[model samples]
Target: MTTTTPTPPAPTPPAPAPPRRGRALDSASSFLRRRPRLRLGLLLSAPMLWLGLAYLGALAALFATAFWHTDSFTGQVVREWTLENFRTLFTDEVYRTITLRTIGIAALVTLIDAVLAFPMAFVMAKFCSPRAQRILVIAVMTPLWASYLVKAYSWRVMLSGNGVIDWLLAPFGLDSPGYGLLATVLTLSYLWLPYMILPIYAGLERLPASLLDAAGDLGARPWRAFRSVVLPLTFPAIVAGSIFTFSLSLGDYISVRIVGGANQMLGNVVYDNIGAANNLPFAATVATVPVVIMLGYLAAVRRTGALDNL
Candidate 1:
């Protein structure tokens, strides 16, 4: 009797209920579901718009034009499709020489830019005060605001057979100094210097000073600390700067045309093909090589998550 009374007295309590969805979340979910068509359309259209308007349409038109034959006698493209245009590029040793020279120059310029940019970037990051840093940044980026054509032309004058440089250095036994590859590379370097410095500098600036301090605390000297800690941390920046230098140098026809002496690059070839040879399609094809190569590198960067900050 006592146990039965106690059991009956143990009153039951109401259970808590689960929370309902908020109006905002519910509305969002509903909107997402109802707007599937719009979302899908956006997804599908973005790439088409980019490719159709930016690249494929122009490329198709250019390729179509390449089919037209270039008349060697008239130095004009005849309105007929022919393989002769493509064959001429491959057969002629002049085009081959030009292509190779362009590649070599681009490589050399990239190497020089990398080596030159790194030290400057490091100095700016590790030594300079914030005010000094700002001034230096402005100095590095100042050239970009100037006319690229004017700069190249100025370089041409500077590097001419007898230019102002020779005049300035006559007492020191130096000549117009812009005489050859040295002048071309120097001018190209000057032109694209900012592209290299900015990224590398940004990368170095991002490096944690604590890492360097920690390396030093562990008995590592400054150089060893930089090699082990700073270098790895800034690798992505170096690679990015290298890419900019390489790609820009590779496509620079103006610099080469103005001051390269006999050293022609891919850009000049493309220019020559467009006007002198009248072979737009082959030039487009040649142009596509750099695009594809750079895109592939970008893809690799994305895959590695190295471009996350950029």
Candidate 2:
């Protein structure tokens, strides 16, 4: 009887109450939930303020500065507004030459990068297995981790008269192009090649294999299918990549300085004006050319529906 009398089950301990702050937090969260737009506005306010101040506001100031003239004697940015900087940019043959040369180099670099990236990207996206694709992607991206200056200097050495490239080609009676526009173009193409490859790879990877198969089935040869299906589909990616290459090259002064020898691009002009010549107004005016060019380019491509695709 004693054994059969079971001890009263111990009363279960009451659950610990939630902390007061947790309840306050829940209430706050509930408040935010009730006004999503306010929450969103609060969230966006910081970034919008930063973007306005650091970017748009700076750009507006720069545009304003471009309209002003510099005081030569004091080498100070004069607040007086004038179109003289723009008139000089337009009328000066040196500016015209530099502008054209810069454009040519940018275009050449973009063309080179696009040509080189497509085959590699296509092979990676279409032909390679997932593991192989990953390896290739890693290979393409590895160089990007290296300093841009390091790569430019490396190319400078390679293109030097007795450097790696010339040493290799010496026996073959071939020589490096040496330091000039060609060198600048090559260095830019090499630097920006990964940018070109990544976008085209993403675009090609997104393309359905069935479309390519259907093209092949419909009496299209390999080149024809690529020309009709692949190129059209990938054009937006090409444009996207070109934007990086072209804009980077357009604004680049460092690489040219490192490897360009006597050559000077638009960027050099801007730099010289800002530093050597002490002409901030002229420098700002020169800087606006690339901005205007990029804007015009975007506008032109907007009609192609490519801007949206990017």
The residue pairs that clash in candidate 2, if any, are: none
- Tens digits of lDDT, candidate 2, 1-310: 3567675567567647767869988778889999999999999999999997778999999999999988878887889989999999999999999999999999999999999999999999999999999999999889888999999999998898889999898899999989887888889999999988988898898899999999999999999999999999989888887888888999999999988989999999999998989898899999999999988988777766565545
What TM-score does candidate 1 get on C-alpha atoms? Answer: 0.74
Tens digit of per-residue lDDT, candidate 1, span 1-310: 5575556566776536424756677666678778999768777798889987778887767766666655668766577767665676667898777666666776788788878888998899889999999999998888888998899899888767678777788889877766466777888887777788888899889988888889999999988987889888887887777677777877888887788777677787788878877766677656655666677777877654456534
What TM-score would every model get versus the actual structure? 0.74, 0.91
- 187: Cα error in model 1, Å: 1.1
* Residue runs of model 2 more than 4 Å from their true location after superposition: 1-18, 22-24, 303-310
Error of 1 at 278 (Å): 2.1
Indicate which candidate wins on TM-score.
2
Model 1: pairs clashing at backbone N, Cα or C within 3 Å: 67-81
Q: How many clashing residue pairs appear in each of the predictions shown? A: 1, 0
